[model samples]
Every structure is written in structure tokens, then in C-alpha cells.
Target chain A: MAKSKSRTEAPQDASEDVVMQELPTSHQPDVQDDASMAEVDAEDDAEVEDEEEIEDDTQRVRLLPGSTPTAASFEFLNEGHTLGNALRYIIMKNPDVEFCAYAIPHPSEPKMNVRIQTYEGTTAIEALQKGLKDLQDVCDVVSDKFVAAQKDFKKKSISS
Target chain B: MDYDPMAMDEIESKGPVIKISQADTVRVKFELSNADISFANSLRRVMLAEIPTIAIDLVEIEDNSSVLADEFIAHRLGLIPLNAEGIEELQYSRDCDCEEYCDHCSVKLTLHARCTGDENMQVVARDLVPSGDRINRVLGTPIINESSDGLGPLIMKLRPGQEIKLQCIAKKGIAKEHAKWAAPSAIGFEYDPHNKLHHLDMWYETDAKLEWPPSEYADWEEPPQEGERFDFNAVPDRFYFNVETAGNIPPDAIVTEGIKVIQQKLASMIHDLGETEGGENGDYNGPRSPEYNGGGDGWQDQGFTTPYGNGGNQSAWGGGAGGTTPYGTTPYGGAGAGNGGW
Candidate 1:
């Protein structure tokens, strides 16, 4: 289940189109050069982002049985949304979700950087649905990159 | 508080103190019509109610169940369900309950060992119950929960041929010091091909919570071993129906459909027995056996209408029915035309 960190960064530099072209061989792509490049980019992004307003957009929720939402301070996110607007809209719906600022490219939708955050004990499916609904409910959302997707059990189980 | 050097030394010398040690038991003395029904469910429920802990480690396979040979076989061989009942023992993870012994909660081991051992052992409960400890080892894992102080990890070993026993001790409470024991509740079944009615009875000895009026005819007997032919009529009302889950097919499964129907009826009978209320013995005090019905003539009404009729008057697998044979005559009566047919 464990893969070398060195082999998972080439496509990060390549645009979604380039990555898509290499999708067939994505599983075993060259990672040494890409990983080093990713490390450098991450460092650069970290410095710039630390200096700027620290917009903690990341959220995480424990997927468990019989967990309910409490003290709503953060909203959910989903697909079909204007970029920045969805994040802000989700925050409005759930005023309780604290921002950690960890964002990653949506696995299916590369154009958008999806923020990952945590929530209280709740089913992964329910949490994702709520996040998606919130993202779609907001108006005047923008799109430098806008996409939403929930974690799927199939992918997690297979990979793990 | 005062401390005694000698006492302290004694305590230290007893390394890895098994403060909470028990042997709780659940003996299911039962009777059932040799029918094939979901008896496995009943076995599971009884195990759960009693053991409540001890993660099942492993189950061995032995024999399958069959309806032939006038006997019943368990579902599996060796140990049917590897992790059947052992979760509770893991919960007894505390000190002794006595003045310093284990008490109400601690390391609990639940064990369920069945007679039959040749079937695919299904996992009925997996860490189903937990301990009442405030601190848990694994958090966020499927088995352990951090919120309520009950769920705890289980680490114990169990193998085949051993009487399945779940033992535990109280963690910090007074109950920990006290040793308790439990055995699997006894269960049995019987099938009458003639009446086509399966009769089952399940019994257990419990603290005097209710009084069970005893029936003079409280016929309890031991079940037959594998491949043994049992006089279905002679099977008492309360015998252990030894079943195998793997090695050999239980004699009861030979007549699959009949046994299945009988199993359903037996399950209901057990439920009824559980619901019976009265006395501490779990049985009411009354004339033991039913009024001795004169001779074997009344056997048909009692659900044993086979070619040889009820087993009361016959011996060994019914002598192929009573026939009027004068001088060396060929057997030509009842279902004897062919060697079998009920």
C-alpha cells in the first residue's frame, strides 16, 4: 500500500491536459525530478502564503457511525461552483468549521484546488453531501479553479 | 495508611498478577426436533448475552450436519466460529476486584465452543462488546472508541478441542476480585419422520429469579456421537444435540428438508422456554414424567408415527415394523417392502 514519495510529482507541474494525456500510465509515472520540483514549489508557496492572509480553508471530518454535526460554523463544498465563492459560502453555512488551509487538487477535477478540512464524527458520505450542497447553494462564485469531490470508499480501500 | 514489608514483598513477588480471572459458563441444556433451521443464530445470541467480550481468535472445522442415521451433527468441525465468543475476556483488563481483586469490569474473555466443527465458521461478533476502561489504547480504529470508556482492544489466544470458556475480572471495582464462571447454554433437537414435527427444548440453570414448574417427565439425555443411530422415540425432551460444522455431515442433515422444518419448530420451542417464568430452578415442581400412557400405543399422538411406530416398544432403529410371520416367511408388511420409506 505504501508508495515512494519520490514518484508522485511530475504531473503537478504539467497542466491538467498534460496529466490527462499521461493518465494511462499515471500509476507508474517518473517521480524523482517531479518530487524535487514539487518540494521547491511547496516551499515557495508556503513562504508566500504564510506572509499573506492565512486563509485556513482546509477542513476534515472523522467518518464514523452515529456522529452528528454540532456547533455549525463551516459550510460544505461540492462541484458546479464558481471558485472562491464556494469556499466562502460553505464557511457561511457551517460557521463552526475551523480552517486549516490544506488544499489539494481534486482527484477527478484537476483545475480546482479543493480544500480538505476536518469535522466531528460523521459518515463520510453525509459530510461530503453536505459539503457539495453548500458549494452549489452559493451565488456569485468565481472560477480560477472550482471543483468538488468527496472521498470514495472504493479508492481508499483499494489503495490502503 | 500503613504498609507491611512482608506483605509488600509478597505482592511484588507475584509478578504479572492475574488479578481478574474467571470461568463464567453457559450450559444450554436443550431439546429440538432434528430439523435444519437457523439454530446457529440461537447459538450466537446465547454466546453474546453471556460472554459479551473476548474477540474470537479462531474456529476449527470438523463435520457437516446430516439428517440420516437417526442422530444430529453440529454445523462445523473442530471449532466452527474461530472468533465466536471471546471478546468479553479482553474487557476484563483491571486489577483484582476483592478488597484488591478485579471487579465489575476488566479483562473479559468470551468463548463459544460447539460440538460440531466442520462448517464454514461465520464471524457472528467481532469485538462486538467492550470494556469500561476510561483509557483506551487504539483511537479511531474500527474496534476501539475513545468517547465512551467501554470499547477496548482484545489480545488473547484460543484453539480447538478446548471447552470454549470466557473469563474476565473487574478492573477497579469490587467485583474484579471475585471469580465468576459461565458455560455455553446447552441445546438439543429431535426429528420424527412420521409425525413430521420437530421438537426442541433449551434449558439453563439461572439464579432463582423465576420458578419453573417441573414436569415429572423431564426427560433429559445426552446426544448421540457422529454416525451413531439414535432411537428418535427414545430421545428425551432435554438432550444436547451435538452438531459438527466441518469434518462429517451431521446425521440430521441426511433428510435435509425434514430437519430444516424441525429446526424452525425447535427454535420456537427454545424461545418459549426462555419466556417461561416461575421459580429459581427454571422449572416448576410437578409430577415429573407425563402420566405413563399405557404401553406404546399412544406413541403416534406424541409425534412418532413411523413404520415401527413410536420407539417406546421397539429397539435399535425399529425392527422394520411388526409383521405376522408364521414359518420362515419373507418380510412383506409396512414400509418393509423396500428396506426403507417412512
Candidate 2:
């Protein structure tokens, strides 16, 4: 089963790589070298503007164009399977979501792309928001229970 | 929201439950029930790599006459867990406003040991004195036999006339950057002990049970019958976790901190998404225009709309386009299957 799954997945991975490679050049060109040299002249004027633009350019999440309400792909910066897998699991649990999956464009780059396909009634964004909210709720409960358990254990040890 | 007793009861029963079987300053064993494997795995991974702790990140040696090399002693010092009680208030050095390091970002520790007498002297974690009152070595409990004097982990030994003097800068960091910053020494996670879910394949010549004995945790669930029909569709919902800390932070606190880290990550992602939602036409083209163009023309034009989208998808990647030619299949479809259908 695993072997056949990999075979079917091989071609798809190749295409995603193409997207990853083309993304950088289109957004921010070779402006860093020019910006650094310009910094010595103005010091604060153009340098601050360049820094702001760079910050805006590196926004953590971006919605890919051509995304419909029901189906969409989102690119996440500086994220990996740690958030991706958990979010996928939570999103898949919602009955409105038809499919949910996440992939890392490349190992070297800390980026994750998540695709969510929802049923007709619900939008992909809504499903994603719900997934994030649900995951947060789960963590809240886990933390609370753990803290309470620890306190109980400590009290038991002290009394005994 | 309307209060429905039946709905409330169902939600309460389905919510995750955590039961701590054993807990101490250095170790904890717990069972997380009513949760999926992915959620449990995330928590475990975060604990191992994301939850921050204080460790000696920089060392400036002024004198060294000990047998160990300077780098070796520095490495050892980095592994020693310091008290991380107020770590939440401490800022990462990179984020701090100070030039290099300050009290807000780091704590200074100095160790000056010399053996002038005939006998050899032992330099341990306890010997490193902290400049701040809040930071110190996490003394091991005598009950665990960690040490007779509770001096902490040994760094090195100095012979007569041998001396070692060094200044260490302990800073907050996560294990993802360096192993020394990890709070847990070990974390064990196990699920589906009977292997009824077929998550693991047992290899045995004659008897599978003999070759692959059930783990101790298997007792928590009933054993499969000799000729019982297995539920192939059953998913493992219960997870057993054993967390052993390195004494910098309490074991129970580590689990909570890990969960909080996951929560923070999700919250941050949600916040970012909300910020992009305000963009025109519901399209986010902030700095990721290249991604937008690549994904739009590259993915959509190739019928890489959805992983399991309907046919006619073949035409999208049917061929003429040079961009699509590099990646023949639908991009998102490949993304879904490539990530092992996560």
C-alpha cells in the first residue's frame, strides 16, 4: 500500500517544486544589495522604507490567487509538520471539509502550504478558521488538565 | 448559545482527558485519551523541539589547566539544566534591545575552581555560581540517588595545581536550534499496543506473540482474542506518554508549556490569516506575489486545483505549457499525496 502511494505521489511532488522555485524571484528582486549601499547615504530615510517593505513582503501567510471560497491553498512561512499535521487533522474532522492536506515546498526552506477543499455549503477559509480555533481549544483543555493533575499529584505527595 | 444538556454531555465526553500516572520534578508519565494521534504527536514534537529553556550558550574561558579541552567543558556546561522558573519573562537574545546581552535576555554564570591541596578536586554543575538570584542549577533530589551531595551533573575533575576558570552566558532557546536547550531528556509515546490497527507489522517465524512481546502499557487495554475478528477501520484514540526532564523545568510544566506553544503557533497563524482577509478581492498579494503568480498560473492552469478534484484535470497538465511541463501532474494533487495524505 505504501509503495503504490509513493508512486502516485512522486509526480505531484515534482510540480510543487516548480512552484517553490519560481516564488522568490517574482516577489522581491535583488533589492538588498542596493538597499544596503543606499543606507550609508540617507542613513534613516530610504533604509526605513526598505525595511518596512521587506517586512510586508515576508507576511507569514498568503492566500494563493485563483482560490475559490470552497477550495483554496495557503502558504505559511516558517512552519513545518509541527503545525501542519495538527491543523490538517483538526480540519479533516469537520464534516464540511471534503479534503485537507499540507506540504513543505522544500526541506531547506521553512515554509508550509496547506490546501483545503470544502463541501458546497462551507468555504475553505471558514474551515481553516474553525480548524485553528478547534486546535487551540484542544490545547487549552490539555494544558488545564495537566496543570490540575500536577497540582493533585503534588498535594497527594505532600499529605502522604 | 443555547444550553443543550444532551449536546453538552456529548461534548464533555468527547473532549480530551489527561491523567497523570506519575509525576515528579524530573519525570512524568501520563495518558492522553480522546485525542487523535496527530494531536498527540504534535505535542510530543513541540516538547522535544519548541518549548524553550535556559542553557549556557556562550563561554569565555580565562584559564584552563584541566584535562578536558575548552570546547569539551563548554559543551558539558551547556547541557546542565538551570532553574527555568521565570523563563516565560525572559526575552530571546535576538529579540532583546541590548547590544549583545543583558539581564533581560541572559544570566551570567562564573566558575572558578582550583585544586591546591594533594587530593583532586571535582568541578560540577553546582560549582558554577549564578550572578542572578533567579537562576541556579536544578538540584537533584536525594531520593533519586542523583548525587550524595546533590551537587548536580559533574563537569570535570581538576588535579592539584590544575585550575579552570570560565564565564558562561546562559540564554533562553529552544531545542530546535541546539540540543542543550531541550527540557526533556527523553519522551516516549506509544499507541495501539495490540497492533490491531495494523500500524505495525509483527515479524516472527512461528509465533508473532513470542517474537514481539506486548509492551507494559498493553495491559491498559484488553488483549485481542485468539480468533476474534479485528476492526480494520478502528483508529487508535488513546496515547500513553512518558516524559523525563533534564531537571531545568518540571516534567508536568513541560507538557503544559508544550501545549501552550502549539496554541501560540495556531493563534499566530490565525491572526496572520485574519490580517490577509482584509486584502482586496479576498486575495492576499502582500509580498507573496511570486507565490500568487506561480500558484495561480502554475497550479490552477495545470488543473492542480484540488488534490482529489474531478477529471478534466488531465488537460491542465496535458502538456504544452513550459511551466506545467516541468511538473506534469497537478501541483495540489501531488502536494496532498506527497505529504502521505496527511
Candidate 3:
């Protein structure tokens, strides 16, 4: 994937996004990028995150393979939360994850694909549900802190 | 965890989904019936560390007249992942009985450079020549095929007043011993199955009574029966797989090679088990290929010792250059010099 560096950067600055960033992995990425390494092998795997299908409020999860509790896909339509990155980060947190990765299949589709891989007894769907719920818990804590910060700012303004 | 992988039959299962983005990288999604996390974990672990490939383990620097230190050049040379085709034809040095080197064990590469003219010049990987007849320098891409994109990374630089000569020995080994011989730059699989959509809203934004798998993913021949979509909307147990190469080997070759290694290891284990159990139960008829001894230590020793080849040898043609003789014997040996840099 010809991922431009600028594409992976946070969208705070328009022109600041110029470098593609690699997804974090269990091993250090430095040794892999040897200076003498042939450039052909340096093709970046990252992609420009699609910011279209993002809705900050809506969250959806669809069970795949019909009724089986084996697999599931979580799609965020309008929330530009970068859930794939978050979910992949969560998967990495689990040393037992069979497989985990994020994909933005088509350039026209703004949806992120967060797939969970499990085997034997633990179904991927269960792991996915757990991850989503855990993420929500983290978000709730962040939301509370934001509200507290707002109240503090308001009090400071009244005193001034 | 309770299921035995060996007992499981290859059911009439669906094919794996494959998506190749570049020549060096590929993504695959497939299902494993009657298999568990243990099996998947083993495959991933073996592919990363057990699968064998060629690497420059030892370097002989006869003369170093360049600005860079001797170890620096040697380290850089070891890092270049050679084109690993026909790797199955080679043998791990530990398994080979040759004292110094042998055709079946190691391939020799020589780099002899000197500044001929008064003008300033540079030396590159194009100067290092692998005994072409004995070893393949990976096909479809040359060692120093520098393009506009600079996909061809440089090996070393030389000056007009400098001169250098050394012999490099390439041997078969796994990533556990050193990263130079690692199978893939990146490899991991996830569960991704062909999911079927129940209703209209469960799929795309279309209202029409769509067919199973809809139309975008209509590659499947036989669509699901009426009232049942292929669950094209949700795939269970199916996973996304990715594998990248370090330019020496293609992504597909590395994947196939990795699988081959895993199969061999499993087959050996099964054979060893059958041999020991058959003696007690009578009539053991499992395919016996990689023979194992009657004790636990033999198996464990085989598992640990042979994987890493003999390292730390800097002999200057002293018990070294095991397969160097094959170079002159091959018709292409002399011709290899004309192929790379002058």
C-alpha cells in the first residue's frame, strides 16, 4: 500500500500531514529499517485513513457468517475515532490474539475493517465484543475528565 | 484445545481469499476447520522462526582499503536478504557433514574491488558476486537493480584510492539464530469468513432484493439458496493474512516456503510418535520419513541443536569456502563477473 506519511498524521494541520506512519507492532521497527536495506523492500504498508464514514456518536457491530458466534465486524460510519487503530492496539495488548489487522478496502468506501481472529474455544466475536465494551469504558473515563476540565475553565473565567 | 490436528480431516471446505497488493506483500483470509488457537499459533511461530533461508553468516575480508571499517561492511552485507529461490534444494549446514563447506551446504560470494582510474568512483552490491552456479541471486529482481523509486538499496561505497577483497559464505538458517535469515518481514493471520447479510439494512444502503454476496463480491459460483445469503455481510472464523519480504524473496515464495517447513516439522513429529507408540501397540503404519531415535533426548536435541548453523568462522580459505569449488565447475561462474558492476 503506497501509504503517504501525511495521510497517517492527525488532521489538526492541513499541510502538516506529509509522512506515512507504520502501525505499532510487538517488535521494534528500527532494526527492520536498515540503511543498506534495498529500497524495493521499503514500500510502505500504511494507508491514508478515510475520514468520511466517521460519525462521532454512532457505533455498529455486525455478526458475520450468519448466526455463528465465530466472527464479527465493527463498523463506525461517521465517528472518525480510528477504531481500527484502537482495536488493533487492543489486539496487540492481548498476547494470545490469533490475528488482528485493520483495512480500508476500497478508496471509495470510508469504512474501517476491524477483524478479530480466534481459535479453539474463544470465538473472535466474543473477543470483539469485549474489546468494544472495554473501549467504551475508557472513553467514558476520558469524557468525565473533559467535563471536569470545562468546569474548571468556567470557574477560572468567573474569577477573572 | 482438546481437538487433535492430526486426526482432523480436510473437509470439503471453501477456498481461501487472497489479495495481493505488491510483489513483495500479500493478504490472505481463510478458515481452519476442527483446528484451534494452538495450531494457528504454532504456524505463526514456526513461520517466523523455524522456516529456513540463506544469509551471509561469515565474511572474510582479505584486504580493506576503503574508508568504512571492515566490520561495518560485513554487517551491512549480512543484512541483505538474498533472493531465496530453490531454497529447498539446499541443506542446513548443521545437517551437512562437510568439514569446511560443501555444495549442499553453503554458497560463496566474492567482492574484489579497486579504484582503477584517476577519477573518484564508488563500489556497490553490484560488485559482490555470489557463486552464481551454486546459488541463485533471486529471480525477477537483480541484487542492485536501482530504480527511480530507489527500491534497490545500496550495498557499500568505495573511493578511488581504496581497494577491497573478501569472500562471503551463505548458509541456510532460521530467524531464531539471526534476523538475516528471517522468513518474512511481516506475517500474521486473522479470522475472516464470508459473512452473509440477513436483510437490506444489514448490508449496503440499497433497497432492492439483492443476491447472496450481493454483486461486488460475486466471485463465488454457486450462490446460497433462497432466503439464505452467503452471509457475505459477516464472515466467521475467516481471517486477514499479510506477508512482506525484504526484497531477497518474493512474498508468495516466502509463504509457500514457510508452510512447507511447518508441514515437514509436523510430519516428523507424527512419524516419531508413531514409531515409539507402534512398538507397544503393534502394527504402526504411519508415513515414516524423518526418522527419530527411541529416546526423548534425541528428539529434543534434534529440535534445538540443528536449527542454528555453525557461526563465528573467519577462516581465509582455511576449512572455509565449502562450496566454492562449485563456482569454477559451473559454466556461468566466469560469466557472472560481467553481469554486475565493473
Q: Using alpha carbons, what is the TM-score of model 3?
A: 0.42
Q: Can you tell me which runs of candidate 1 are displaced by over 4 Å?
A: A1-3, A6-160, B1-28, B31-36, B43-50, B53-342
Q: State each candidate's chain A TM-score.
A: 0.27, 0.68, 0.46
Residue B197 CA displacement from its true place in model 1, Å: 7.9
Top lDDT prediction, candidate number: 2
Regions of candidate 2 where Cα sits further than 4 Å from its true position: A1-58, A151-160, B1-12, B132-148, B211-213, B280-287, B291-342
lDDT of 2 by residue, B281-319 (tens): 544343334433334344354333333322122322232
Which CAPRI quality tier does the interface of model 3 achieve? incorrect
Per-model C-alpha RMSD? 34.0, 9.3, 30.5
Tens-place lDDT per residue, model 1, B11-60, is 23311111101111221122332211222223222222222222222222
Best by TM-score: 2
Tens-place lDDT per residue, model 3, B1-342, is: 322112212343222222332231333222233322333444456567767778887899999988889999999888776766777778888667689767688878888888887876666666667775574445212244345243345666666678889988888888878988887777755442223433333444563345334443234324456776354433232224456566556555555555455444334323333333333222121122122232123223322111111111211121333312223335666532233321
Query: After TM-score superposition, what is the CA distance of residue B338 in candidate 2 from its true location, in Å?
Result: 24
Provide DockQ values for all models, in the order shown: 0.01, 0.26, 0.01
Which stretches of candidate 3 lie above 4 Å from their native place?
A1-160, B1-37, B116-120, B132-142, B145-152, B188-236, B278-342
Cα lDDT of model 3 overall? 0.48
Q: Candidate 2, overall lDDT?
A: 0.74
lDDT of 2 at A14: 64
